[model samples]
Target: EFRDMKTEEPEVAPSPEKDKFEIIGKSTSRIDGEKIVTGRAPYTHDIKLRGMLYGKILRSPHACAEVISMDISQVQSLPGVKAAIQLKKGRVTYAGEQVAAVAAVDEKTAEQALKLIKVEYKSLPFAVTEEKAMEEGAPQVRKRPNVQKFNEYTRGNIDKGFKEADFVLENTYKTAVEIHHPAETHGSVAKWEGERLTVWDSTQAIFGVRDGLARALKIPASRIKVIKHYMGGGFGSKLGINDYTVAAAMLAKQANKPVKIILSRRENSLCVGNRPSSLQTIKGGVKKDGTLTALYLKNYTSGGIGRGDYCSEPVVDLYKCPNVQVEEHSVFTNTGASRPTRAPGHVQGTFALEGFLEELANKINLDPLELRKKNYSTKNQGDKETPYSSKGLNKCYQLGAEKIGWKRRNKRPGEGNGKVRRGLGVASQIWWGVGRAGTQADVKLHPDGSVEAICGTQDIGCGTRTYMATITAETLGLRPKDVTVKIGNTEYPWCGGSGGSTTTPSVAPAIRDAALKAADYLKKMAAENLEVKADDIIIGNRKFSN
Candidate 1:
């Protein structure tokens, strides 16, 4: 009737040219493509209940302030107002920190009610940049030191390594904060059925939201259900439960009706998370023969009131270096916190490391690609020199150079006739793409010969639903259309949130195993009907025959 499957490590497979599979490596159309393009798919913002109320949040105008008092009596008395609650009554650390919320019959009424609530605040000195926050005698963003050493790493002796080098270079680089403005902004629609709460949210993690709500609302996880059918994007901003989601649920419970809350663009820009800004100073020593002698980095970054990213990973892992030292400090500013953007630290780290490597190659009068080859790392230096299971970087570089016609690159770095100069450059990156443990999938076989694959993973426009169907159909020896994919509901078999590029690798294996079990069952049933052994039967054109 049902099968639950889990896969931990990836099974090694033969090369694509030698292996044969029906749908595993083929190009198949996305299953949800028609529904999405036709605008028939139901996003969280499209959900509307019979007695739904629109919720709006009121945010602080000052970067740092202490709320003296709040008067919401007039807002509560409004005709269409259903519920009003104060979110923050004490010190606000950021400009857009939520201070209050109101739910009313319509969006206009909710917006109007927010204006009626009066709040008094006392402003405090604030730092808006990392330089300002790190300045001596600067206003303290938190109780701790303004610039706290967040993380550090050291390897061999830097002094001895630098002494062996022929030349050294040091420079500073900076990266600005970036926002994840997903097409569907952060939002939630909450409905309460007695003591149980069901929420439809545009989020990457349903279980994360469930756990966050349980902790915040003092309720059991079983009492909450999170669902998301289709999400425009998250890019890491929607990984955790947001304050707006909690506000909607509380408002819906108080008003005894469903509540919908969607953040405006400005609110999202100010309060929602971003990729923290980083200021890195890197020093490197290289020999004339293109061998790296020493590398040192000091990074200062700010994530507003939250911890900043660790931007020293590439420096330690990307190349072979004996002496390396990295120190990272995080400063707090009065702005939005930083969340994991796509690749988090690696993207920013790669930019700084590669830029410096290019300049180092030029200084040594060597080809950049050849210089990188001189210090290629076969093992992960960061993880105690563990040999990689497989490394295709050399092949990738060779192929890339061939495809790009590397021989035709400019001999001089900035040689061009017009103001526009053309140059060819390359950089490499490494990241975590491993599947998460404890992910699950379920497969069901119906008497009508139709199959269904069920998992709790949401499709964040990454072809998850299509791939789920593809894996199930491939394992069961059936067309993809014969399988029905059910996902984005917490009631289904548990799958981890879609992030870190983990959804396909995590869910596909489980789905494949479940389908294999279902296929075995179907084979057993077909053998009995065909008067032959299960292994003797052949499946073709959706038919099981002997």
Candidate 2:
């Protein structure tokens, strides 16, 4: 019923011809599969510390408002309440913004403390929809215009290219905002030891949180240890330091006890980041011979207070067209700032671009796949001169077409009518998945013959620990279960966040490097003992031979 596909784009820097891997290319179970399925694995939500207090935050109900008067003195005097603080002093950006926080002996007491704290806010005009935000004389989301142009790119002449075209097509596509509801809601457990802080968070980035917490608390990075051994999920929501984590830390410091804060499902929906909605219009021109002549895209996306998704990368890079133009705008609205969703801009952009291309192909009585093949690009993105060293997209298209029986697809839209219907469509996207040069890992060989591979990379529900064990064990001539993989800690060698599809590429190389170095060291030690050269040593099956 299913087929396993293997493919890759060549590495930027290829290594020497390597030996056949015993464990890597074989069928292997996840190293921690048992522990996870048996409920023995510890996640941030499962973490509990001694003298732990529950933290609760009071949030603004108004989408746009300025805090007029706030008092936490009553909350501070509440019985069983350990600490209380005013989180926001002036204007609140969005409805779920933290206005105040308190830590109490229990969840009931914490909830009671939030009710005792009173705050007054002056509500302001606001817009929550893209159409409403883009209207003229709209209530300002920020100092800048509500509809602010963020990106513009042009390659070759747009007018000339359109003039030369035989046929043209134009259409608009829209995507709604998407939210991440992980099995375990966002939470943090903070414990203080004098000036040092230790926080277990449900996050995708350990080092990022550590550095962020260090800056927020105005303490050295070395004093904060952020750990995330396991997390339910965080498509992109947990990539940075969250306000709740900071609130937990502050509460713990004031209470002189550990603090834990786990958000409710409602809180998760209101305050946490989500994928920004995109409205894109794509216009394209193609020749009679199925050659793409020009492409243009205008997109408007919203990210509340911050903007990051451009929604034009696919338009500029996914196809081969000399005359390409793109204009992107961020329509600010009163909502939670958008975080990077899985593939972020590419998802919306590709949907629009691919659908547009399909329409262009239908207009010319040509197959969509043939049109794509006709304009296959070798240059890097839209560059006229530069070339990517590795690209296997065309091959993928062929493999996919053959496997899915492309000929079975309908010739026109809505070609069939039935209670159950299936449609076959093809879509392609250009992704930049590469390693971070700054990523680092550590391999430690203990005196008792135990091995450990450590990094600050969070698991992010992606079997990071399993692959880490596999790589280290394969390199050191051991089994995956034999190598203890320790990750998700700031104390380990620093690694970048697990976003942008960079975790595997960034981490695999770093851990392999560390393991390879350890292997080389072992070779030298064995050769020195045997009075032989290091190159003559052979390592396999946990044995050294000369």
Candidate 3:
């Protein structure tokens, strides 16, 4: 008794012709360009509420310490102080860990209040770098082990593959830790009305913050409303809830008024997340004909007191090889935890893998691009024999080579005759860009012939609002100006947080479906009014007729 459950028709293949779209791919001005250029667009930093108090956090100055005593009596008794909280009174694993927080009438008063509070600490030995952390007898940042095996993958027999190889090469590569510094720093402004809480945040994920607040404050998710009309940037650091947001909500409740807490530049650097540093050693065996025989990778990375990024993806899947092995280790150190930066693991992994491949090609007397083409894979080696939905790497290589005049490169590496030497190099990258499902949207057709599209996804400054408007207008046979796009509010249809390049693909289809349903309804209505079949009705030029 099995029945097919798919209700929607298969999507039509996209046409490469730009003329197929009325608004897409055209040289149109940004919808919000005027407001942004005129300095009239409001951002989270511009939020202000009546009777609002400013909040500041007190952080540990030592890399590692044990809090012996903390006295906040003087801070609480400050003239302009409204609420104070002690965040930590026990072991502190890293510098900049929040020890306490204070809310006052003004920023100056809050700074003064922070200084008035007293604390005594016992310094402990700490390791700030991966080299020092992995050394024997090093101060342990975590209780279990300083260096722990994080992940590993193996396929086929490496011994057999290496035996058939004509050449083998190995080298170690290193990448430094990077910090995420958005134009506007991380912050939050929280206000409570009765039991309902409203928050204006500079973040990538609103529902993430909403759920985090619910768990932190022990309240229902429905009682919390997170809003971010405009944000400067997030990259990846702002994808999750921050402690400052929770502290602001608590401080507001204690003071019985709204509270605004924005991290200072220094605070943002020390406390917020960073891209984990990676040290990868890759070994490759290749035949004289440029076919890859075996690939092996050993990665050591650190995310401070947290986990490390997986930096072996490129070695495992970027090329075709029967024998592949990868092992990753995440070491703990006395520093800030890490968050996803741009491409996270794949960027660092590709750097090492591609460089190794190029060196291997040189040893085999073959062109680097030619070697890659010889080992081109149409299936994802990592996921068994699953064929790729689309494989365009070979075409990309051809186009890129033709555009760059690759033949004009120096005949030999570094064969220049000046103090400054020149050479041409190439690299490759692979990552997941598929969208997640379970997104939704709504379209409303007004009696006056105007249309509106609603969704809860944030724009994140990628012209998402413009995309919705364009899709809706194209579906309704109306001008983009005739459609109003509403987004960045939790009260609308639910949408997943903006990250992993998921927002556009996920929201566009939902908007298209909603618009299609609206169009169907309008056609049926027109058919009833004109005494004709629905299929005979036509919609164009802002009118529906038979």
Number of the top-ranking candidate, with lDDT as the measure: 1
TM-score of 3: 0.95
Q: CA shift at 184, candidate 3, in angstroms?
A: 0.8
Q: Which candidate is the best by TM-score?
A: 1
Please, what are the lDDT tens digits per residue for candidate 1 over residues 297-349?
99988889998889999999989999999999998998888998999888889
Q: Count steric clashes of candidate 2.
A: 0
lDDT (C-alpha) at residue 286 in model 3: 93
> Residue 373, candidate 3: how far off, in angstroms?
1.3
Q: Residue 228 of candidate 3: its Cα lDDT? A: 87
By summed lDDT, the worst window of 10 consecutive residues in model 1 runs over 9-18
Each prediction's number of clashing residue pairs: 0, 0, 0
Per residue, candidate 2 scores C-alpha lDDT tens digits across 440-471 of 78788988888988877888878888898988
Alpha-carbon deviation at 102 in model 1, angstroms: 0.3
Better of 1 and 2 by TM-score: 1
